[model samples]
Target: MTQFTPDLASRFARIALGHVERRYPFKLDQVLLGPDDRRSPTELHPVFHGSFDWHSCVHGYWLLARIGRRFPDLPEAAEITALFDRKLTPELVAGERAYLDRPLSGGFERPYGWAWLLKLAAELEQRMAPAERAWAEALAPLAQAFADRFRAYLPKATYPVRAGVHSNTAFALRLALDYAEAVKDQDLAALFRHKALAWYGADADCQAWEPGGDDFLSPALIEAALMARALPAGAFVPWLDRFLPRLAAQEPGALFAPATVSDRTDGKIAHLDGVNLSRAWCLREVAAALPVGDARRGVLGKAAETHLAASLPHVASDYMGEHWLASFAALALETA
Candidate 1:
């Protein structure tokens, strides 16, 4: 077992807060500057590439929640959650009927409604004090709102799954499970727990598409393992134990690789490996959650180190001014 030094944790906190400040806009209530800021007309487009457009914002907000929990003294906590409520409240109230058709919405056409929201809320809840819960009363309501939406989607005829990085869904569900368990809402927690177990068992085929060759993809896998472990009886343990070693082995190359490009096909030749620091944090979370004496625990340690080493440069970057990668590295470093 390892604990990240205070200096490392502070660096992560700085980066996380930096990302939130630099990327987020109160007016838009979303992270990142629209393409309009750039001089070139052609440059005016979404900044990331993925199935869901809002994942960056979602990921950012979730990261912020963790930061908020880790450093409750900062006023950014209320500011962050307020921004989250601005963008997310409608969807929660919209229930299952909410569709991604809105040009601005980033989620894919799936039943992700409640699962992800609960995760965000849970992260926020972690930092709450007994006296502060009253001030944060909306947190529980917001979580319930997601539950209503998720339950609405549960009866669907068919659910489409992501082809790569199944961790997207897994983290969302894991967060939901975490939220449920922490909140002592047993029934709500069980719902997500059951669904996570079912998906993990059926997701063998999806694992093939994992960005195992990429460091960024490892975080998603960590999240998947986390959600799987969220179930009782060590449900996700065996497979998670099996998954880390190979991913950890790839760390040396992936870390040395240039930054991960935002758009793989843009032809601009950007490096983006640093953008995936969240994977390290997720890996640590999974490792911490696993039952002790499991063989995979050792592998988790190796994977955790690889992830931290990969993120070292960004954590040390004095000029980047706190981006997503910074906070993620901080959290992962803290967990490590």
Candidate 2:
């Protein structure tokens, strides 16, 4: 599982195709400025109204696009292309972008959904096939909308969110950074880099108090992953050392250990599964950032392997998790 094989990619692709358009049991992140604000998910987001919620739906698309890119000849690729063709047209995507203009929509999905949107945009932007290019072009406006949101929001953010859930600033900025780099938006890239360092540069000796009741992310590992991508190698190692100073000894046993998912039917309880998957992602990112032959590399790599093992099996276990968990699994397995 160190690298995604064709079969693994197809499996992940099939999982995403199962739900990207299954518009039911949706959780709407809406604001009611008036009576008309009570609209259905598809009405609010034509292209991203499936897979449980908007953010999850966006990441679901990311997973499909990623698999399509990495394994173009997989059997599931045709269905993925058809899904993109049907859902990513200008008219549909415009509805998705227009949702942001509502009076009460300023914070529709905030950083979590915002990050996933940009992540989808970035993946599409990298595409080479004709269909993929059109998908990117069709979705460009929506991507820019979120990117604009980031530009306006970051300047006034002032402080970082250290949560392990949707509002986590580290996870948002890390994904947005990829989008920024892909589109060659130096201004946005600079903004992200500056804000990221300003928020996390001095952070040290993180207590690693994590894996909260329903957390789907590792606040500790994600922060380190952001710093790893944000800072230069020369500076990143020192920052990482200070951030997780006891990594060699695995002192913060919480980080090295995977979370226990007692139940997957409950949406919140299901997040622990995501915690394992996302931790594996961040763990791999951080371990890759480490210098060659570093002892911490082995430690982090081992943790990542075990973490993936804990959650990868259940990516399609229950509708509560199946709707979105595959995206995190893709993140964990595809990066390498």
Candidate 3:
């Protein structure tokens, strides 16, 4: 199985470094209230202005931070430190917070970007290295902004977004749970767990209608992963047994197959590559929650290896996937 080796860490860090601040070829998710709202990515987002979109840029920082933590001696650590010191400042983070306060901005990046921002904050808060600690301090208000959004939004989310794209709620919630767990925010954790259970509880016999043409996530697996993260072993195991009743047989096999990306240069089609990678991440997470003697563990583990093989090599092949795929690769490898 592919591992989070220093060589892979260096490569992932290099890919993130290449584009965290590349301001062009950008896609803005802004609510233009007036003429003055028309602005460049850098102007609108002081810290996150690259990697194609705000959410991608956020996770790009997360990829660098996570790799830097795991491989502290990496040559890229200096550049990562320099970048965080220069950009992740109180003033810049406040600009990001200001964006959230704008009129009609309630949906700006919504749950997806909101969740990624918290995950980045969680990575920074895990250690007390001077740079990491300072970055964490600089970013606290913005992270709070997102966490507050979650607290406010979940009450009215009535239904979860089950799409396999950025709108997917399960993916966002699972990422947010990591932040909640890291910070020991029991209230936050309780809120997220309640929301997840309310949305997914009693779900059984997943049909696994998945691999949506432009999907970057496996809807079925992400739901399973979120439930695994939210519930206890005694509760989750039985729930999962009913959810994927034929897991031992690999039924609903759309999930076991890696998505095929015929055109990596097309931004939407490139999402299929992300599907392979993010699936690897989710598969491992679900497998980890299973009992050691379960046959599904080996099955899920092998599917994860196949999915990683399918996309890990293509992470840096094109600017489309190049802008963001390495982050997913890091998630999969680090989890593995």
The model with the greatest TM-score is 3
lDDT per residue as tens, model 1, 1-336: 445554554555445444442432211213234664333211221221111223333445566566666665664556655655553443342432232223454433233434545665666566556543542354455456556656765545244243223234565565567677777788876767666655555444223333443334443454455564565565565555454334434432442232444444321221134434555666566767667885545665676666556546554343322233453555566666
How many steric overlaps are in each model, in order?
11, 0, 0
RMSD values, in order shown: 7.8, 1.1, 0.9
Count residue pairs with overlapping backbones in model 2. 0
Of 1 and 2, the candidate ranking higher by TM-score: 2
Q: Per-residue CA lDDT of candidate 3, range 35-125, in tens?
A: 9999988888999999988999999999999988889899999999899999999999999999889999988888889999999999999
Off by over 4 Å in 2: none
lDDT of model 2 at residue 237? 94
lDDT scores in order: 0.48, 0.89, 0.92
Clashing pairs in 2: none
Please identify model 1 stretches exceeding 4 Å from their true place. Answer: 1-3, 19-65, 68-116, 127-131, 164-167, 202-209, 212-216, 237-276, 289-295, 315-322
Q: Per-candidate TM vs. native?
A: 0.61, 0.98, 0.98
Model 1 earns a TM-score of 0.61
User: Which ranges of candidate 3 are over 4 A from the true structure?
Assistant: none
Tell me how far the alpha carbon of residue 59 in candidate 1 is from the true structure, in angstroms, after superposition. 5.4
